[model samples]
Target: MSLEVKNLVKKYGDKTVVNDLSFTMDKPGVYALLGTNGAGKTTSIRSILGMLAFESGEILWNGGKLDTSKINVGYLAEERGLYPKYTLMDQLLYFAKLKGVSKEEAKKRIKDWAEKLQVTEYIYPPAVKGKKAKVKKAEELSKGNQQKIQLMAALISDPELLVLDEPLSGLDPVNADLFKNIIKEEVAKGKYIIMSSHQMATIEEFCEDLTIIDKGNVVLQGNLNEIKKSYGRVNLCVKVEGDIENLIKEADLTVVNKTPNEYQLKVNKEEDAKVLLEKILQTNLPLIKFELREPTLHEIFVEKVGNVHEE
Candidate 1:
């Protein structure tokens, strides 16, 4: 199934938050919606999911109007949406019921997800020998555990389309990896996912296609690999034991970052990198590492947004 957003526009009073934002998911995989804070990424997502109204635009699913009520869609919103005082099991079941899942099936899915997310202790408290078993409330869990519960709620119904906003935002490294693995599994199951996150590295890992918005306007949108190729491999990284400050000056390389461990430089062309390498070799410095590569997603995002601000 394909999901398409055409000329989506949303305004609040006199300000337009999302203007002519458009993108398409023609097949199953991850699609990234990216922007800086208040850049309209979340607005575009809410509009697509039919949770918020837009001024003028059409969100279509399989050539027809997109409606959440008719389709199996799951969403993990950026803002946590749990009843803080309610039991985790109760909330999961409620979310599942809203998605039309059977009570019996919902319990089974909850059990499985709890194990996968390592939240079984909260969802299914161990017997207290002589005391009553008690399930933990949403507020009792850590932020990361609460996030897992929210994700379980999103996946309980096995939705065909999933939308995750900052899915790994507050998790520790271990929990973040767990979430990433689950996302990979979902992709392997051929689920279509729309993800929005500030973590460019995570986007690079999962999303092949993406749209980068800036101040409600589309700044870059296309296949990630193609975008990187267009920029060329101008990023050069070098590591050595001795100082290469004067050598870098002679080669006219712009240092993007310099640390005790390495020198991150920017070169205009491949020839410039070769010249730098030659100079380093001539100095008989102990070269630990030298590599030339394309600009990463993080670099591209910064450049795009920075240019938009300048304009």
Candidate 2:
């Protein structure tokens, strides 16, 4: 099945928060939506999930209109949505029921997920030999563990379309790896996923296609590989023992970053970097390392959406 979002528009007051944003996923894979604060990334996602209204757009699932109420959809919102006082099992079952999962199936799914997410202790307390075991409340778990429970809720129904908004935001390194593995597993299961995260490295790890918005306009959208290829190998990194300031000045390269032993330069073309390499070789500057590569996702994002608010 395919998912399509065409000419989506969302406005508030006089400003358009999301202007004619569009993309499609014809198969199961990760699609990334990236932007700075208030750049309309969240707004656009809410519109796609039917959590918010839009002025104009066509969101199609398969060959018909897309409706979350009728479709099996899983969502992990940026903001945590569990009731602080409710028991973990209670919330997961409730969420699963809302998604039309049978009670028996929901219980099985919850048990499986708690073990997979390493939260079995919180969800299923072991029976004490002579004492009673109490159920765990949402407030009882740490932020990271609570995030895991919410993820369990999202996958309880085994949704065909999964939307994750900043799924790894507050996770530590270990939990982040755990979440990444789970995402990979979901992809292996052939699930369509839309991920939004400020972590450019994480986006690069999963998303094949992406849309980057800045001030409600799409600054970049395409296959990640193709986008990086288009920028060419303009980013150059050079490390030398002695001072090479004069060489850099003579070569007319823009120093993006620099340290005592290393310099990151932005060249206009491969020829410019080649010229700098020639200069370094001629001067015998004790070169330690030289790298010419395409711009990183982080670099590309900064270049396209400079000082813009992230949403």
Candidate 3:
């Protein structure tokens, strides 16, 4: 399934959450949606999922409006909603059934996912304190485990499209790795994924295309690498021994942050780096290190958000 959101708008009284947002994604690939808190990320997701009625917009499954009454879509919210009183297997099978999966198929898929996620041991609820919770009613598991259940709820049905919101919210590094590998495998199988996250490292590692919104407006969108390159205004930090200030100065770089012995140069036009490097070598400055680095996602975030915070 494909998603096409066009002219989306949402408001609460005087406050507009999503302002005429639009985007199109087809085929199987990971798409990351990023924005600061209260920047309409959630609103947009909700609108597309048919959870909220937008003032005016279009959400299409393939090329037409989404048939909320018929589309088989799965959603995993950041705030997970799992019955703590239900056994993991029972809960998952319930969701599977809701998605129209047969009992046999749901059972097989649940067992397969449990093993894949290394949570087969958690199939039965653990004892929290003194009382023993029955199979029909159990409430003992870690928050991370609950998140895993949420992931399974959204993924077990094997829907054509998966909408995961902060899917790794509670996972540690190891679990995060496992989750990413699973997401990758799903992608390889040609399942379209739309992920919302604040973790830039995760976004960098997992997503190919991304859309960044600020103040209810999209400031950047497209392939991650291409966006980084085209966004320009990138500063490359070079650490080489000796004085190459004159050469760097000759490069006429902007946003030049420097110390006596080290130099950080911002190349608005990256082509100038080549000319700058040639000048540095001519000066016989000890070229101990010469590298070009893209701006960190944090930097990009601040630029988009327009609020600098202490690092």
Candidate 4:
């Protein structure tokens, strides 16, 4: 089933958080919503999930009105949604039951997810001979572990639509890799996923299409590759045995970044890069590396948003 959101709007009295937000996911792949804090990314997501009241919008699933209560949808919110004092297993079972999973089946799914998410030790302690294991409370787990439990609750029902907001946030490197692999596996299963994160590299890994919002407005949206192609290959990277700053200045190139032996130059056109390359080749310097490429997503995002401070 596909997910579509059109002309979504949310206002806080006089302040508009999301304005005319629109996007569609017609296939089973990851679509990323990217933005800085207070950029309407989360508000648009909550509206699409029916978790927030919107002034105007159409959220549709499979050509019909979307209803999370009746649809098989899983959401991992950026904000933690678990009860602090409740036992981890109890809360997970409750969440699963709320989603219409049978009690026995919920237990089975929880057991499986515990192993897959590497949180089994926290959910179920090792049994002492002739004694029962103690169940851990949510407050007892570390922040990273708590996040994993929340993820387990979201996936216990194996939903068709999954929305993850900052899924890898606050996770250690090992746990981050674990989450990434799990997301990859879910995509392989042909699930429609809507992800929002600040990690540009992670978004680049999973999303082919993306929308970047700034201050309640969409600033950029499209297939990532096509968008990059439109910009053309304007980035140049080079390294040589000796200093080439004088040559770069002579060629009239803008240095985006520079190190002792490496330089990241910004060019207006591919021809500009070619001119720089010709200048460098004419010299007797040893060329260690020279490459021209398109701007990165992070660079595009910054260019679109201007100098606004991102939270």
Candidate 5:
């Protein structure tokens, strides 16, 4: 299913959370929605899910108007909601039932997901310990495990679109990879996903398309690589002491940004870096590192929203 949000506006008294925001997402790939906290990412997701009312705008699924009755979507919020005392299986099955899956079907899917996540061992009580045969509580598991369950729950219904907010928050390296791999599998099965995350590394690695909002407005939106290229600069990482600072001070390039040990410099459109390289070598400084590449999603985020405070 394709989603189109046209001139969406959401206000809270004198404050605006979403300000005439608009974007389109089609099926078959992952799209990342990136922004700092309180930038209206959550508010937009709730509007899509029909959980809140907006002052003005149109939300359409496919070519028609978007309505809950016309499509089913799965959402994983940043703050995941789960009953702490409910066993994983029981809780998942209950949710499955709400989605119209039969009890037997829900049980089977739960088993399959448990096996995929390698959490089958925790599904049942320990017979040797004579632990009462009851479902383990959600809080009983680690935060990573809870995140995994939340992801599984979002995918269990096999909805057309999966909305995941900070889906990788609590995962360690291994499990984060596992979760991403699962998302890839789902994409292969033709599921479209909209993921909101603060982890730029993950977004750059996984998302092909993205939209960035700042101060309740979109500052950048498009294909991930395309947007990065648009930031367009021959990025050089340098680690020399003397004269390096002076080179930055009197260079024909725009210093995109800098750190104590390194800096990002943006030259004019397609400006040749050969001149910059020659100048660096002549600086009587031993260069520890230097490379030319485009800015990343993270860099773009900081550049676009560095000083934009919430109104």
Candidate 6:
């Protein structure tokens, strides 16, 4: 199945928050919607999921208008959506039932997900010898654990289409890795996922295609690798036992960053990097590291957004 958002436009009275945003997921895999805070990423996602009204645009699923009521879809919102006073188990069951999952099936799925998310104790507290077991309430859990429960609620239905907004935002490192593994498993199961996160490394690891917006405007959209390739391998990183400040100036390379142990430089072309490499070797100062590679997603994001502001 394919998901397409075409020329999506959302405005609040006089200001447009998402302007002509468009992207397509032709097959099952992760598609990233990225932007800075208030850059319209969340608005675009809400419009696509039919959670918010849009002034203009068509969100199509499998070549037809997307109707959440008729299709199975899961969403993990950036803002936590849990009843602070409600028991976690009850909330999960309620969410699952809303998605038409049978009580027995919902409980089974909840059990499995609770185990996978490492929140079993909250959902199914160990029974005290003489007391009734009590399920934990949303407010009782830490933010990270609450995030896991929200994810569990999203996955309870095993939705064909999943939308995750900053899925790892408040997660600890261990839980973050757990979430990543679950995402990988979903991809392996051929699930269609649309993820929006500020984590460029995570996006680069999972998404093959992405759309980056800046102030409601589409700035960059395409296959991630192709985007990086278009920019070319202009990034150069080197480390040596001794200083190479003069060598860098000699090669006419722009230093992006420099520390006592390493130097991050920018070269206009591959040959410029080669010139720097030759200079370092000639010094015979124990070249520790010399690598030239494509600009990372973080760098690309900054450059694109920075350019937009400048324009």
TM-score of each: 0.98, 0.96, 0.83, 0.96, 0.89, 0.98
For candidate 2, give the lDDT: 0.94
Worst 10 residues of 2 by lDDT: 302-311
Residue-level lDDT tens digits of model 4 in 167-203: 9999999999999999999999999999999998899
Higher-ranked by TM-score: 4 or 5: 4
Evaluation by TM-score, superior candidate among 2 and 6: 6
Q: Candidate 6 overall Cα lDDT vs. reference?
A: 0.94
Pairs that clash in candidate 6: none
lDDT of 2 by residue, 214-310 (tens): 8889999999999999999999999999999999999999999998889999999899998999999999779999999999999999988874444
What pairs collide in candidate 3? none
Residue 12 in model 4: lDDT: 92
Best by lDDT: 1
Writing each residue's lDDT as its tens digit, candidate 1 over 259-284 gives 99699999999999999999989989
The segments of candidate 4 whose C-alpha lies over 4 angstroms from its true place after superposition are 129-131, 307-311
Task: List model 5 lDDT by residue over 71-101, tens digit each.
Answer: 7677788997888988888889887877777
For model 6, the run of ten residues with the poorest summed lDDT? 127-136
| Model 1: residues with Cα > 4 Å off, grouped in runs | none
lDDT of each: 0.95, 0.94, 0.79, 0.91, 0.80, 0.94
Off by over 4 Å in 6: none
**Model 6: C-alpha RMSD to truth?**
0.9
Q: For candidate 5, list the clashing residue pairs, or say none.
A: none
User: For residues 259-285, could you state the per-residue lDDT of candidate 3 as single tens digits?
Assistant: 766677777666887888888778776
Instruction: Please give, for residues 4-37, the per-residue lDDT of candidate 6 as tens digits.
Output: 8999999999999999998899989999999999
